[model samples]
Target: MDRNALLVGGAVGVVVVAAVTAVLVPGVLADPTDEGPIRPGPVDVADVSIAAGPATGETVTLGIETRIDHRGNPTQNVSVLVRAIDAESGLLATTQRVDVGNISRDGETTAATNLTVPREGGYDIEVALYREAERVDQAKRSVSGVSAIKPPYLQSTTSFTDTEALPPVSYSIEDAGEDRTTLDLTATLTNTGDEPAEDLSVTFVLRQAESNIVASRTTVDAGTISAGRTDSVDATATVPSGYNYYIDAVLMRDGVVIDTARGAANLNPTRTISVNQTTEDVELRVEDFEDDDDRTPEDYESERTRTESSAPGFGVVVALVALLATALVARRWRQ
Candidate 1:
């Protein structure tokens, strides 16, 4: 072979060998800046904690804290996904995701998220740790009695002072006459919370012990009661003489009753009444008279009788009134 031909043949052979090597061993001569296969670091869910947050309306917020343990290598683009599922139905209630960026050290890292769920039943909280789009570890926790959480506006800081030594409701006779008697009532309240109680009122209702008839009712503005302090509200009520009465003091805020207390006034010399004594089991007696203001006891009785006789199905009306009164009394007695 000629020298030029031998040289060209040798160069072609070298090129062929290089092409074969490049096809057989892929990426051996690839770009140095190119990325390799992604091998996710070892991550495990170390701990999961759930804390209840303030409730609003029918929903309550749950704070989920997830602790991740990174043992092998550093991780990047880590995230935590929190889900709240109803324990009874196994249905998803809510979900949230939080990004914690990169975990470079070989220690523990934390990720947190908040999920809002209905305040009705128990829930199972699930936490999942992810590296980018791949899930690495998961954990679960359970919480119950979510309905007990109260909203901020529904929570009261002030309540009526209830103790044996310090009675919440008290009364004294202001004047006595043959037909009627005037009494002064005082309701003592205490703030057992951290914030002040504002825009409050106390309603005093006088009910005859024998018939459970409301003789008089009055409301007094209590204004603001400071935190960790005790305050009093005074009211006046006049009723017919020679009758024992039970004074019902209802603590109110924004027209809603929060607490209640009871006291007795033994105006009748013949019969003595105690606050704890039970009265007759009769339907709630709501006065039917449109205007009982400045009306005498005899006039009230006459009007009540006349109205009951004239109105048909008075028993149903009385039953509805009883239900309403029972609900009101229940709310008042609630702690």
Candidate 2:
């Protein structure tokens, strides 16, 4: 081959080899189990509430409240970013990033963040929902600035809004004392929310059965309790006699009803009696009658005369004939 032709042939062969290697080596060396990035599904954001917006000079800390809903597929490595923009100047005032680890398919989450804005002005808050690097949804709202010196309304206010459901409470009644007709109503309060519970009060009502009349009522305050913690309180109430009774327990926080529990109690003591029937025969025996030895001679003679007068004439004749026959036989033996 000529020099130029040989060089071209060598280059062609090298290119062909490189192409084959590129196609086959990847398939042969690549692990079949190595999968690529996961595609996330749709997400929805709604119900954004600005809980607090206390501003101090140029810096304002925003309390953003919102709910995130995941749909269709589960997502991992999710995050949320909130931005405060000055609507007049189109300037961004603050930004906050929240790391939402994972959300299951069709699941929902409530997110709250306190973002510190570096400027003081009227702004519109924007929330961007993301799964990894992709933005799935966005929401925005406008809010007024608040004073930093004063306490946040969301923290100072005693309302059930945004508060978790109260833990369950169970009530039981036991004797308070032996000398009195009073009972101790015990209420066990449990905290099921992820946050602390405060300003809790429980009201116990002991009512007569099937009647609205309250026999005894008392309220007990159970102070602050941590999440998943259990606390209890006792109240003394007089239980009346001769009537069935029940108990109604109400759990409250900031004058809002968190939970309610009801139970019945049997106050009147009682006894039970059972009667049964059986089939069986019984027998009786009597002793033979004997004459009294202590009887006087006059009494015995009177008794004998009455007996002789009452006897049958045939019985008397037979007795006399037997005696005479016995005497005759004895006399003949003697002769």
Candidate 3:
């Protein structure tokens, strides 16, 4: 055979051998079984909120927020969008979810969105929240999308009428005998919206404006707050120091933060009650004051964040000396 003909013939023979090997390899291969669990996608459902106005032509914004879990823990990759839906038509409308774009997740997020209408009008805006899975609930390659727009808000779904807006929070701390402090704080949280917040938790974090958290405690498990009804969750956290310090109260539901209010651990002996769904804080200093304590005011410390509060007085003195030296130099130059 010629050189070119020989090369071509050799390639043809190799092709024939590969075809035969492929035909035999299928019969020789073993059956493969998947040993992994069936992984499901992310939860689509999330709580939503709407702002209502008395007069027409008012701008309305719908915010959708959800908690997505991966491997049974909350994931922060969730995104939300709003869409226009025919109120009574039960029809799949346009892909309007793209207009709103994705909202950023701030640590754990609560979004406030504004959707401007054409005129003073009201239509059922079907909002959708999307979640992208980095690693899905199951150990497998997956993608997911769920929708929970029909459900009410996660923390609160209703609004309060004019009459039911509880009074502001009022509280004070009193000396409960020696080396003990009792903080009496009161607030009323009414079920403003339609749905109920289950496992509603209210915690009071008493922090010193000068120091970090001098004392704190979870005040209420507050069962199920009924719709349109108001309930109170007031607690007295006993600590060692006089509540000369002040801090704010934080409200959380299902390990999620919702609202916070200005609170004062005032050294007030007067007893008071906060009527509104808010908090009242008070503090009382001891009649006899001594300055020789070297430990934390209380032992039942939940969380302590030490900041740059109590800096040594030496720094202040040095700053004063530098200022004096600068002034003396200016005076000599003028002379």
Badly placed stretches (over 4 Å) of model 1 are: 1-39, 51-54, 76-78, 86-92, 99-102, 119-123, 130-136, 142-156, 170-183, 193-198, 206-215, 223-227, 239-248, 253-335
Model 3 C-alpha lDDT per residue in residues 91-210, reported as the tens digit of each score: 433323332223333233344444443232234555555555332221111111112222222335422222334543456655466666676876556676677756776776665433
Q: Write the per-residue lDDT of candidate 1 for residues 1-335, one digit (tens) a residue.
A: 79999999999999999899989998768787878775657888999988889798799998888989986667789988888899999999988889988887888888877888999999999888898899888988999999877777667878888888878999998999877789999999999878888999999999888787788899999988888999999999988777788999998888777778999998877678789885434333344312456678999799799998868656778879889999999999994
What's the true lDDT of residue 257 in model 1? 70
Q: Which of the predicted structures, 1 or 3, would earn the higher lDDT when compared with the native?
A: 1
TM-score of 2: 0.32
lDDT per residue as tens, model 2, 256-308: 56556665555444521111211222221111112256568998899899898
- Report the error of model 3 at residue 321, Å: 45
Which candidate would rank higher by TM-score, 2 or 3? Answer: 3
Deviation from native of the Cα of residue 273 in model 2, angstroms: 99
Clash count for each candidate, listed in order shown: 0, 0, 26
Q: The CA-based lDDT of model 2 is what?
A: 0.66
Q: What local lDDT does model 1 show for residue 330?
A: 95
What CA RMSD would candidate 2 show? 28.2
